[model samples]
Target chain A: MDNTNEKLGVGLLYNASLPEYLEHNIEQVDYIEIIPDMFWSDEGRNAYPRFVDLPQWRHQLNWMAKQVPLVAHNIGMSLGTLNYFDKGYIQFMKEMNESYRFRWHSDHLSFIKLPTKGPHDHNAGIAIPVPYDKDYLAMLREKISFITEQIELPFLIENNVYFVEYPDQDYSETDFINQLVSTNDQANILLDIHNLYANSVNHKLKARQYIDELRMDKVVEMHIAGGNEMGGMYMDSHAGPCPDEVWELLDYAVSKAPNLRGITFEFHESYFPLLRFDGLNKQIEMAKAIWNKYTLQPYYHELA
Target chain B: MNSPDFQLAFATLIASPQLCKQAIADEPSVFDQFALTEKEKTRLRSVLRQKGMSICCSLYRMNRITPLYTQLTQTATLLGDELITLAEEFWESYPDSSLQFKEEVLAFGQFLLAKLEVGTLKFPYLQEILRLELAINELSYTPAIIEKTVHFDYDIVAILLAMDRGTLQTERLQKVQVAYKVYLEEQTLKLALL
Candidate 1:
């Protein structure tokens, strides 16, 4: 899957409010990035057909798939979970790809699902950041190999937004990501600029320095969004439009990431009222400006 | 360092602030259930003391309750400020959420139904609204169009409208027993008076 020359312009992460928006403005979007898990319901491990399609959601997804190219952003993989791996979930993803024909797929570098004694697995209710240690990296590498074998799509791991950082980690976040992608050919990065901004505000770190340390070529996609202040900390709540700082970071990131295929603007559907169709268009327009600035000319000329 | 156990312990702490407080207080048996390595235990203890842990716990509760808020809008809106305490109690009883929207909504709906049946949760038209919302959730997942009926003993439309307006007054509304058929037709929720 050589996406080096592929450049998908500004896109939106699919949400419940998107059907109506996409209906009127399909041409404005280059592609749709969907969370495949949202389109189906997983009955517990005991159920014969463990994954059931929610017709209403599938109807919407089918409608959108016809309108534009789609990429899957998954939340169920939980690849960082230590000993537990749901090959069944990966198998289901393969079936979904067969049906939808996604361009590429990605999941977070964090764990959310924990196996429980009950019939269903326990959701951590949040994506928990994994410790950047050699042992965990090795664990993820094996899991990534299995996933790539099962589904031949380009796989990406999004950098996590950590509210709490573990003590005595083996590597910094950028080094960890660089090492992981260096070892796995099919694995790359989904550079979430908002998550980096959140971490910068919360931890008092330089976001640019963090970005500079990263292997820019590994970045295939980037996410930008708005968040609000909670408990005196700037949180990545995805509440509304992208902040000015996020746009700046995205501009810098886009200039560096030559292989970047998409700049996805994410906002929770509940915030649809805040970012009505017009507001959403504004975000996409801003992203396209950055995209065109870097993607229109030769990479070297743009840098010069 | 026993990554599974460490994850379990961390997840448990996030879901229950009571356990988090105990862990912070250095309660001897707070983490007796997990087989965590000493380093893991030390890390958990240190992390719990950070202010971000509070945010993590808040985020956990918000995520668990989102399905309920989205699916059971009328029931949740009617519960008003009481939803927080009720949700906390519900989480205390059932610590793990499947994270599936229908499953979480149904689980929370069943929890509310049990409370309403036992006379512990009392309110005018509460049962009717809850049953309607739960039916809608169930029907959204059901592929085939099928009708399910709910009997309401009050002027349900007036009640719902007033609730939407945030000016619900049960005493001002009239009592009228009626059965409404709730079903999904062509992927759209429709209601018919029966």
Candidate 2:
């Protein structure tokens, strides 16, 4: 297969543990996705705007940014929070984007911070699932709009792997995602196939039906990663190579998503030995073969 | 108005397992301080009674535990038998887990130090190990960490070498009058013992 699909490209998420793999196969992948939080240390904060010290990662990251196509995937946006918008976080993102010039920015749909004024105003410290209600849609839409205006980039939200049950008034999870993106054309989706699969299996929902329900036309990028079972619940762990189920979803997504631009693989640093050393090249080969099938066969009537 | 309150309440409950236990029981005043509406209170009641407990506890604890494990490896090792229980105790002591890695680690280290200062924690190597770990964390991933040349206040190397592996002795370490410089060079921590 060729290096990239003219329409869609394959990429690796930049995990620090796999420098050898990244360097060895630099030409193989077309782009690199990076998490912004790793580049800086948080100083103390009191007011709305918090200052961070970034002298450490400046030179190294700048050098990496020049190497491949850098796309922004932030974990700290806390978009579902009811109280705070994290304007400081936005400012930091803007500054980083200015330096790296990322193609597009995306964050998870989960709420990492509880924004209300109370004792525990600190971030929830993990991507906590948000309620899938139409009532909450207005809030998330406004937040997305605010983020869009502030970042001035084509923004997207990845589907969250939710475990909890929240009271929903109207919309199911897919309904919520579909309506959210359909409201604005520019707003897109980074359909994390692993997350979708994990959530479906964990919650006893049909995985294929979930994919069928998604507004695939809105999907711009897709994520493939591995997970593990913990406490009888499946996690979007990113701990190993792509599971067969996720690969199948990737094929389905590639066939369905007309506007898809990227396919990225993710794994935590702890699994570098297993995934990077053993399975990375094979994963890339499989992804390339599928990318051939995906981009080769026409998905859109106009293109055909 | 209610959603914000509900979020805050749920976060608080997750952070405080004791309060969650109380809220789960048939206690009306357990959630009095929380700013929850009637509907929100009903939902909280449902969560406590019927669903979401497993993930709620796992998510809350895992988030807090990640940095703790990463930062305080030696201290965690030192408290081998008491690690799990003490971790929970430390978390309960400082309930609000911060995303700031340094602050959270430092605070937990200090909490252990306080436990050592009192008769609460009886681990002999806790103090030096925690201090050394904290310094390493502060220095970060750089190749070298430099500090102003000064006479050593703590003789960490001797305490480490002389201390028996058995019993994890409780005798207070005598601060040896030695001058030394500690820094990382060539990815190794070098101590200039004088």
TM-score of chain A of each: 0.96, 0.90
Residue-level lDDT tens digits of model 1 in A1-304: 5543466888899998888889999988999999998887787787877888887788899998898888999999999898899989999999999888887899999999998877688899999999899899889888988888999878899999988888887899999999998977788899999999999999997999988999988888999999999998899999999999999999998888878888999999989999998999999999999999898878634543
Candidate 1 residue spans exceeding 4 A from truth = A1-5, A300-304, B152-158, B161-168, B172-178, B186-188
Candidate 2 lDDT tens digits, A1-304: 2222235378888776856776677777878888888777655346333444444455546766777878889888888877668777788898877777777789988777764343224767567667776657888898888777777777888998876666634678888899888777567899999988887787787877887899887788889999988777888888788888888888877888777778888888888888655488788778887777767664453442
Model 2, residue B130: what's the lDDT? 77
True contacts kept of each: 0.72, 0.40
lDDT of 2 by residue, B1-194 (tens): 33676777777777766787888774476777766777677777777753446667777787787787888876776777787788789887777665577778888888887888887888665666777777766666322345323243457676556544543365456766565555655335666765
- Candidate 1 CAPRI category: medium
Top candidate (lDDT) = 1
For every model shown, the clashing-pair count is: 0, 0
Best model per TM-score: 1
